[model samples]
Target chain A: MDGHGGRERQLFELGRLVKAGLTQPLGLMRPGGVGRILAVRSGEGDVERGLLEMGFVEGACVEVLHHGFLGRDPLAVRINQAMTVALRRGEANAVLVGPLLNRATDVEPTTDQESRPS
Target chain B: MTAGTLAAEGFRPARIALVGPPNSGKTTLFNTLTGGRQKTANYPGVTVERKSGLLKTPGGHPVEVLDLPGSYSLRARSPDEAITRDVVLGRQARETLPDALVCVTDATNLGQHLRLLLELRQLGRPLILVLNMMDIAQKRGCQISTEALSRQLGIPVVTTVAMRKHGVRDLLGQIDALLNQAPAGDGVTAISDWVEPSPDAIRAHHREVERLLQEAVVREGAPEHLTRQLDRVLLHPVAGPLILLALLFLMFQAVFSWAEAPMDWIDGGMAGLQQWLSAHMEESLLKSLLVDGIVAGVGGVVIFLPQILILFLFILLLEDSGYMTRAAFLMDRLMSAVGLNGRAFIPLLSSFACAIPGIMAARTIAHPLDRLVTILIAPLMTCSARLPVYVLLIAAFVPATTVWGGIGLQGLVMFGLYATGIVGALAVAGVLRLTLLRGDRQPLLMELPSYKWPNPANVLLGLWERAKIFMRRIGTIILSVLVILWFLSTFPAAPEGATEPAIYYSFAGLIGRTLEPLLAPIGFNWQIAIALVPGLAAREVAVAALGTVYALSGDEGAVTEALTTTLAQSWTLATALSLLAWYVFAPQCLATLAAVRRETNSWRWAAFMFVYLMTLAYLAAFVTYRVALALGGG
Candidate 1:
C-alpha cells in the first residue's frame, strides 16, 4: 500500500538519501509544496501534542504554507484542512516528511465534505 | 498546607483568593489590594508557596488575601495551576480553601478571559468579578456596562485599572458589600460540581454570553488603528521573526551598554567599603570576617543587580505592551522542532532571571510532560547569575572586534552564550521527548492580544521587584555562602611563615586539591575545584569565590589585577573556553535542582536531572577543552 505516486516515490527516495540527522534536505523543502509524513522522530506528549495540536499527526498530510525570507528557521505549515501553523525550521525538521505528488489540487476545500458529490 | 493546619488549630483568618487568567492584570490588582502588608513564603508542606497579604475591607473587617497563581481554568496541567485548583477545591493538605474568591478578568479581552470566569462561577464559591484593566478597554473603544455584566454573571462586578490605581476605592466598596452578605449560612461550595460543561453546552453558553455582550458592551470601532498597524509589522510573516531577533539582540546589548557604569559604581563602592574597614578596624577575626566574608562574597552577587534589572525591564515592557505572546507565536515552530511546547517561551524566558520562578511559570504550559520537561531543562538557560562570569571573561579575553559590519564582538559573544543555552535546552528537550517522557506534542494554542503602550508603572514595579529580589539574595544566600567560604579559606590561620597564601592551608584548599583530579579532565584547576563547592549555592558565587581565592593566594599587586588577566596568565585559552562551555550546561545551582524536586515531587527525577546536566556539562567542557588544546591555544 505505497501511497506515493511516481514523482512522490522519487522524492521519497531523495528524502531517504538526505535523512541523516535534521541538517540535510535544505534544498528539497519549499513553501507551498505538500509533503507526506515519513516518520515522527519524537514520541508523544507535548511534542506529539504540539504536532497533533498543529495537525501534524502521523499519516496526516502537511504543506509548507510559507517560508521566511532570510533565516531558514521560521516556517508556516498548513496541515490537512485549512489549518495553518507557524514553526521554526529546527522544529519543522523533527517531523520527517517526503514530498507529495500532485500538489496542484492540494488546496483545502472551504466547505465541509460530508455531503460532497461522490 | 501550613495555612490550613494552622487554621484547624484555631489560627483561622478570613481568607480570600485572587484568581484570574494570564494577562488579566491579576498580579497588579493583587499588589494593590495587599500593598506592603503582604508576606511571600513557602506554602505549608508543599514547595509551591502561597503569597498572602493582609487587607482590611472598607468595613474594617480583617481579611487575608491569597494571591493564587494566574490560571485559565481548572483543567490543570502545570504544577502552579494544580496548586490553584487544589487550593480552590480545598484539596491541598496544608491550606484551607479561601472563604471567597475574587475572579479577575481583562475588561477588553472578555470574550476569551470570561471562559475562566464561567468555570470559576461553576465552582459555586462566593466570588466577585473584578473587571481589571478597564482603562485599556476604554482606550480600545470598548464599552462594557458594569451593571449588566454583574447582572448576567450574578456576581458583583467592579471595574478597576490596576496599573493606574483607579477604581480601588470602588473595589474596596464592593468587597465590603460582599463581606457584609453573610455566606448564606452554608460552607464554601465544592468545586468538583463544576465539571466543565460539554462542548455543545459551552458553545451555547458562549453564544448567550456573546448576545449579552452585544447588548451591554459596545465597540466604538475596531481596536485602535495604531495597535493593528503595529501588529501588522510585528506579526508579519517575513518581518516578525526579524523584529523579534533584533529586539532580543538590542536587549542583550543594552544589558552590557547600560549596566556597565552602574556595575562599576557598585564595585567601586564595595572596594571602598573594604578599604575603609581595613583602615579603621583592628586586625581581628571580626574585621576579617566582615571584610573578606561579607564584602567579597555579597559584593560579587550584588554587582549582578544591573544586569538582572535590565533583563527584567525588557521582559516587563514586552509583557506590558502585549508583544510577549506574539514572540511566542513567532517561535512556536522552532520550539516544536526541539520537542518543547510554544507555551514554554514565557517560562524559558523567565529562567533568564531565576529558574525557581521559571519552573513555577511552567504552570501555564497545558501539557504535563511539556511542563515537566520545561522545569527540568530551564536551569541550563544561562540565568542572571552566570552573566557576571560571562561579562568578566568576555571583557578580559574575547577581543572587542566587530563582525557582521557593526555588531560588537563582546555583545555577539554574549548573544552566542544565550543561543548556546537555548540550543542546549532544545537538545535536552528533544532527547527527553524521544526517550523518557514520550508523548504527543501539545498544540501551540496562544492568544495574541492587541498591542498596547507599556505602562510605565508596571515596568518600574517589575524592575523594583527584580532588583529587590537580587539584592535580597545577595544579602542572604550569597552573603552566607561567601562568609562561609571566607572562613573556610581564612581559618586555621595559614601555617606561620608559609610561602603559599594562608588559604592553601585552610579546609577549602585541601578540598579543592582533593577534587581537582576529578575535574582535571574538564580543564578545572585546584582553585576552580574549590570554587565549585560554593558555586552550588549560586553560580555567580563561583566568580566571587575565585576572586577571594586568588586574592588570598597572592600579594597586594595580584589582588588589584582583574580576575581575567590572572586567569589568562595562569590557564590556557582552551581551559577558559571549556569553563565557559561548562557554565552553559552547569548543574551548579542547588536552588534549581531543589525546585525541580519540589515541582516533580520525585527524588529520582531530581537525581536524573543532576546526573544528566553534569554529564552534558562535562562532555561539552571536555570537547571544548581538548579541541582548544589541540589548536595550540594554550
Candidate 2:
C-alpha cells in the first residue's frame, strides 16, 4: 500500500504478491496458483457478460489447472471450486485477479460454505 | 385461471418441452425417455433439428414431447440458441408452444447448470427440475436435497441416473401428475415478453442462484480426479498433439483394413444379381435398364457404406469421451494464427463427415466474419461422400504395394488425398483473411466437461442413424439420376450398318462429345465428361455415373465385368491421377452450396464458393496431367 491512499480493501489482498507483475490477468496465472477475481472488464461484444455468466464473478476463487500445449494461450481454470472452464488469454484478460484473501487450500465451493455479500 | 379454473382438478396438458444447457445430460435423458421413438425434422425456415417424440403416460394419456436445442440462456447469440428462444416464447412460425417445460441439470456440475435453471424459471411456465447424473454426484460424496430444491423453486424435483436407466420411472410418473394438476389455461403467462437481461441483472441472478445452491446442495468440492489425471498426459503440450495425430492415424488405418470383408460381399452380391438378370430377361430396354443402369449404378455406391460407418464410429466415440473439446484446445493456436479461434475447429472437424452439418455448427462462433469463413472452408474437409470416388480411382490406378516401411500404398494414396484437402482449406482460409471477411479475433471460450466413458448403446444408435442417412441418399438421388442417364444413353439407336456401339449415336454421347473439348486438356475423355454432369448432384454419384456410362459403351457381356477392372484397362495413369487431383478441390455437391446460402443468408457467398473451388480444380488437374505426362507415366 505504499503509493495507494487509504481506501477500503477488496475481497482478499492480492493472493501473495505474485512474481512477474503485481496484479496479473487471470490468463497469466501459472497452473497450481490460486487468485481472487477482482473485476471483469468489457471488451468488444458480450465479452464481459460471457465471463461473468461463466462464474468469473467478483470475490470468486479461481485456480489454473492447465495451459494449452502451444504458446500456452488457452488455459483451463477452475472457478469457485465448482466448474472448470477453458478460455483464451484474450478473453481471460477481462478477468482481473488479485491476491487471495485466504490460503489456496481454504478455498471451497460456494455451495459448501456461505460467504454472504456485505 | 382464465377459463379452466372450474375444470382445473383433472385437466391435463397436451405437449411438453425438454430444455437444458449443453452437456447437462439433457439429450441422454431425452433418449431414455423416448426410447428410439423420436423423429428428427428441421425447424421451418432454418436447419436446426426439431426433435419430437410421443410419450404415452401410464394413465393412457398420450403426450407429445419436444426436445429443444441445448442453450445457456434466453439471450440468444447464434442460430441454435435463437431457435430455442423463439420456440419457448411461442414466436417461431410453424412451431406450437409447449404447455410445460422440463429443465434438466447435471448434478455433478450444478454450479453452472443451476444458473441456466434459474434463467428458465423466469419465463413463468409450468416447469419441473430434473437433477440428472446423481450416481456420479453421489460417488463424489455430494448430497443434493431434491425436496428442498423443489421447495425453493416452487417446482417438483426428481433425481435420475439416465445413463443406467435408474429413477426414470419416477420422473415419468411426475410428469403425468403435473399434467393432471395443471388447469387447461394455467401456464399461459406473458412468457413472450422476455428480453435480454442486463449484466447487473445477471449478476444479481447469480447471487440468487448461489443462495439457492447453499440451501439445497452440500458437499466439499469433489474435483474430477480422472479428468485431471488424464489431462496431465493428454494435454501435455508435446504428448497431447502426438496422441491426437496417432489417434487420427489409427482411425484412417482402421477404415481401410476393417472394411475389406463387408465390401467384398457386397461386390459379389451385385455381380450375381446382374448375371441373373441378364440370363433370365430378354435383351431389351427393360433388361438393359435394370442390369446396366440401376444395379450397376447403385451397387458402385453401396460398397462404400462400411467405410463411411467406420469413419462415423470413430467420430462418435471421440465426441462421447469428451476428447473432442480437448482436440479443439490443441488446435486454437493454429486456428487463431489464421484469424480464427479454436471454437471453429469442432465444426471443421465435423465437416469431415459432411459439410452440411458442419456449416450449420458454425453458428457457435459469435463473430459473423469468422462464421462465414469457417462455413466457406468446411467443404474442403473431404467428407465421406468423396470416399467412393477416391477409392475407385486409387484401386484402378495405384498398385497394391507398400511404401515407407510397410505402409499400404493404396492407404497412403488415400491419406495423401485427405492431406491435399486439408492443405487447400488452410491456404484458402489464409487468403480469405488477407482479402475478405477480415475481423478482430474473438477469443475462444468453451466448456470442457468431465470425461465419461463412451456409452455403447449411444454409440450404436448414432451409427445406425448415420447408416440410414447414407442408404437414403442412394435410394433417392442416386437412383433418380441413373434412370435419367439410362434413357439418354438408350434411345435413338445406332443407324443401320454402323460399326460403333449403339450408345455412341445416342443423346448422352452427343452431349459428352460437346463438352469433351473443354475437359480434354485435363485428360478427361468423353466418358468422364458424361459422368461429370450428374456428379454435381452428389460427389458419390460420379462413381455410379461412371459405372453406368461404361456399361452401355462396351460390347455385350462387358456390363457384367467389374467397373474397377474396366477402368484400369482403359484409363492411363496420368488420367486417373489428374481426376483424383481435380476432386480434391472440385465443386462440392449442390446441397453444400444450399447450406452455405442458408447459413450466410446470402447467395453472394455461395456463388463465391463455387467459383473459387472450380478455379482451383481446373488448375490442379491441369498441372497434375502435365507433370505425370512429363514423368513418362503414360
Candidate 3:
C-alpha cells in the first residue's frame, strides 16, 4: 500500500497538484482534486469492513467532494460514479489514493451550476 | 416438479431466505411477494427482528420466505449481521436451514452487491440472483445482461423493479423454478468448504466482482449526477443543517396540528361509547372494568394513535427517500462530540416519539458500546406520551399570554420542557461515555444512498407495520397493567359508609399513604404518590391515574377539566413544578424498562437503569421543590 507513497513523493517533488499519498488525511488534499484508490487500511473491525463494503477499494477512482461545516471533520468523497461516502478525516487517512491526474476533466465539479438542469 | 408431484411426495412449505445488501430493495420485494401476510417477531433471545411471510405459488403451493436483515457478507461484525450468517449456515438450532436463497442485488451498484453474491454462492445453496431497481438502472443508462450473468454464476437471474407491480412476477417465477428442482446438494455439508472471510479474501472477492462486471454490465452517461446535484444543496455546509432543522420542525408541528381532528374523533367516540355502556349495563364489576378500567386507561392511550402515525409517517418518508444517510452525515460531527455514532441520531430522534421503537432502532448501530449508550439515553427524550402531562400542567399553571413576538407562554414552556430532556440526555451520554462505557470513538463511514422520491406504497406498508406493533403492545402489556391497577384502586370496597371516596380506603390509596414519607421530600402529597405507583407501567398513565383519583373523590364533572381545575386549586406552584421535574427524570415506564431488558439481554442493565433514573428523579424533584419555595412560588 505504501508503494503509492513513494510515487506520490516524486510527484510532490515535481511541485504540481500532487502531494502525499491518499493514505494521508483527506484534509491534505486540494479541494477539487481527483485520485484513484490504492488501498483502504482503516483499522480492523466493522468500521474498515463497512468502508470496504461501501466501495473504498484499490483501483476504484475517488474524488474529494467537500468537507462538513462543523470542524470539517467528515470529508465527503465520491467513489466510482455510483456512490458517495461520507467519512471522517481520520478514517479517510487510512484509505490510500494515487496522485491527482487532472482537476478539469477528472473530478466532478462541486458547483451546482454544471449538474443542474439548464 | 408440478404441485401434483410435490403432493405425491407429501409437500411442505419450502423455506426460502431473502438475503441482500442494505438499500437493495429486499423488503419491498418481500412485501410485494407476501402481500402483507407477514409475521414479525424477535429472534428468540436477541432483539434482531425476525420477519417471515407465506408466499402462495401460482399452483397453490406455499413458499415460506424469511427476510433476513441486509448484510454485506457472510462474515458477521454486528449482532444483526451475525443472525443472518448463523441462520444462513444452519448454525442456529431453532431455525430451519433455508432450502434456497434469493440473493438480491442493486442493479445500479453491481460492483459491491456482486461480492456478497459470490460469497453466498460458495455456500452452495440453490441461489437465485435478483437485480432489483431495474427501472432506475435503465434510467441511469446502465445495461446488465441477466442471462450472461446467470450463466457465469450458475444461478437463475431475475430482473425486478420491486416498487412496481409487474416487476416482481419474474422473480416469483424464478423462485418457483428453484424450489421445484430439489436443491443440488445438502446445504449443511457445504459448510466444511466455507472459509471465513479475511481482509485478503475480501479484496480477492472485490477483484473477481470487478472482472465479472466488466463482461456482464455496461454503463452510459453519468451514473450519479442527480444525487450530486441534490446533495449540493441537501448536504451543503450551511443549507444542509438548515434544511434538516426545518424538516424536523415541520414534522413536530404537523404531529400536533394535523392530527387534532382525528384525535378528537377518537376521544369523543370513546367517551360516547363509555357513557352508553355505563347507562345501559347493570352496575357491576364488569361494567366498571369495561368503563373506567379499559375505556379510560386504554382509550387515553389509543387517542394518541393519530399523532404516533404522523410521527411514523415522517420517519418512513425520511428513510424511504434515502435522506437518512445524509441526515446522519449532517449530524455526525455534533453526535461524535457527545460520544455517539452518527447512526444513533435517527434512533435518538425517534425516541422523541416513543422509546420502545427508538430502542429497537438502536440495533442498527454496529458498535456495541455506542448502541448501549444510545439505548441508555433514549428514554430521556420527551416522548409524545409526555406531551399530555406537559400540556395539562402548562395550560393549568403557566399563563397563556403571548410573548416574544406572539408565542404563547404555554408553548414556550412546552419547548423549554423538551429542551430540558435533550440537555439531560446529552449530559448523561457524555458522563457515561467518559465513565462506565468509556471507549475509543468509532469512525463514521456511512454510505449516502442515491436520492429517490419516497415510494408511497412502501411508506404505507412501513407505517402499517408500526401500527400493528403499537396495537399489539396495547392489547397485551398495557391492558394487563390497567386491569391490575383497576383491581388495586377498586377493591376492598370503599367501606359502605366512609367519607373521602372509595379509592381512599382501597389498597392503592393505603399503599400511597404508606409510601408518602419517602415521596414527601419532593413535596408530593398522597394523591401524587398514588398516581406515581401505576405510572410505572407507562408514564402517561400518571395522567389517567390522577383523573381516576379525582373522580373517585366525587369531582367527576367532565374528567379532564375537573382534574386540571382541582390540581390548580389544591397544589402549590412549587409542587406542580417539582412534579414536572420529577417526570423529567422518572424511570417510571415499565414498558421502557422491559424493552431495555430485552435489548441488552440482561436483567442487570435494566435494573441498573431503573435505579439510576429513580435516584435522578428524586434528586431533581427535591431541588426543584426547594428552589421554587425559595423563589416565593409556594
TM-score versus the correct structure, for each prediction: 0.77, 0.89, 0.93
Best by DockQ: 2
Task: Name the candidate that leads on lDDT.
Answer: 3
Q: Over the full model, what C-alpha lDDT does candidate 2 score relative to the true structure?
A: 0.78
List pairs with backbone clashes in candidate 2.
Answer: A14-A98, A14-A99, A15-A99, A15-A100
Off by over 4 Å in 2: A1-22, A103-105, A108-118, B1-13, B186-190, B341-343, B353-368, B395-411, B543-572, B594-606, B630-634
Comparison by TM-score, 2 against 3, better one: 3
Whole-model Cα lDDT of every candidate shown, in order = 0.70, 0.78, 0.80
Tens digits of per-residue lDDT, candidate 2, B1-634, equal 4222222333533678888888888878888888889887778776677888877777545677888888777777668878888888887887766777898988887767787778888887778899999999888777888888899999989999989779888887887777677654655533657878777667777778778877887554365677877988888888999999999889877877888789888888888898899889999989988987888778767877887788778888998889988888888888878877687887887688678667877887767788888999999998877887887888888999998889999988988999999989988998898888776777577777778898887788778876776687678766887788778877788799976556666787788788899999999998888778767667876775676666544322243347778889999999999999999988757768877887788899999999999999999999999999999867
Give residue B71's error in model 1 in angstroms.
3.2
Deviation from native of the Cα of residue B382 in model 3, angstroms: 0.9
**Backbone collision count in every prediction?**
24, 4, 1
Docking class of 2: acceptable
Residue B99, model 2: lDDT of 72
- Candidate 3's displacement at residue B544, Å, is 2.5
Chain A TM-score relative to the true structure, per candidate: 0.56, 0.69, 0.61
Tell me how each candidate scores on DockQ against the true complex: 0.05, 0.37, 0.36
lDDT of 3 by residue, B394-495 (tens): 767887799989998888878888888888888888999999999988877777788889988889988887888788888988999999988988988887
